[model samples]
Target: MKFYKANNMKPTVAALFLLSLLGCIEACAISLNAQKKYPYVLLGNDYGILNENDLGGFSWGFKRHPFNPKDSGGNYWQCFPREAIEITLKDTGSSADDIAWNDNIADLKIVVWVNQHLVHEYGMRKRLSIIDFERRFNKWREIMKKEKYVCLAGDFVNYEHKNENGIDMDIYEWLFEKIKTKKSCDSYLYSCHPTYEAYLREKSKEASYKFRGISHG
Candidate 1:
């Protein structure tokens, strides 16, 4: 009934429309849907929950998961913060029992952590005795040196790093430096305030605190 020409719109209004459209496209690009095909990391915690097993030496970082949605339980991919991993490591198995606890850890070829670092061969080993697993692990260690950075599922820190491995490495480093600067400032604040916890507790009651709720995976 009524059609308006694009030329009729004011310059500012037209510019705003274009900006909003671009924003929507950028937002859509970042999100992965169930049917989309792209490399993504699966949450080890979710895997453990679905399989009824312990997390077992798994820390937070990038991991390779099945590209197919059906194989990955669902199309949803979740990333947890590094703080969550610290809690999981302590609460989950950390000793000999850890080895046999989660079959998925081995079967899924998910890298296991040894002394807070990735042991590539542990994930590759199949149907081997504990002694043999250790021996072969040693040999694998000799053959492969540890990567400077190992991002795995559950690690919240390096998810943003982009490199040939689908992360921007340089930009990721800059983010860490920014975080470090913030932490340094926080340390100074802690030193200045004897009752930092009291201050935080009071601040928590503020309107800003209420506005920011904990994010779920």
Candidate 2:
């Protein structure tokens, strides 16, 4: 084979062309994934499931969750948007149950709900409570962060504020302002930029509706 002049095509020029092609491929892949992620609730629980005993405990935002420090169950992490996640804080002779009438738990159960539908439900032994609580909490937090719907704020009309724990505080606020402005203009839809309006127009009613669900989370 005849050797071509290696210097004729500079390595930097060849590298730029290759980089452009790779960037296009990456952009396409990202779009494809985005389409697959439909609007769905990232439903979760903080030991919030019903039992024969009282559904005990309270959730005052950012306030320490009310389990004793000694109890490992108090410190839990979970992953969610899992369709659903349910945690059973079974009564273990702590303060959760009335023990005078042989009320000790024979078994405790957790039932996870997705969109108000029961998706996963199970009766578990008392000893597994702490381990299960931690696992479920961590799982929910992971998925919630990824989706940005698990926005921690009081479920009020003006959802501009969010839980300080979020990584994208500024982005969330920006989106919040845009949404509020659009609502003020018209309940239908509006955008600050023509480009955004055009992109929103591309989305189907289903996708847009899903986005509304996301905003609430």
Overall lDDT per candidate, in order of appearance? 0.24, 0.26
lDDT of 1 by residue, 50-89 (tens): 1111111111122434423123221222312222111010
Candidate 2 Cα errors over 4 Å, as ranges: 1-91, 94-110, 114-119, 123-126, 129-136, 147-217
| Global local distance difference test of model 2 | 0.26
Q: What is the lDDT, from 0 to 100, of the residue 207 in candidate 2?
A: 88
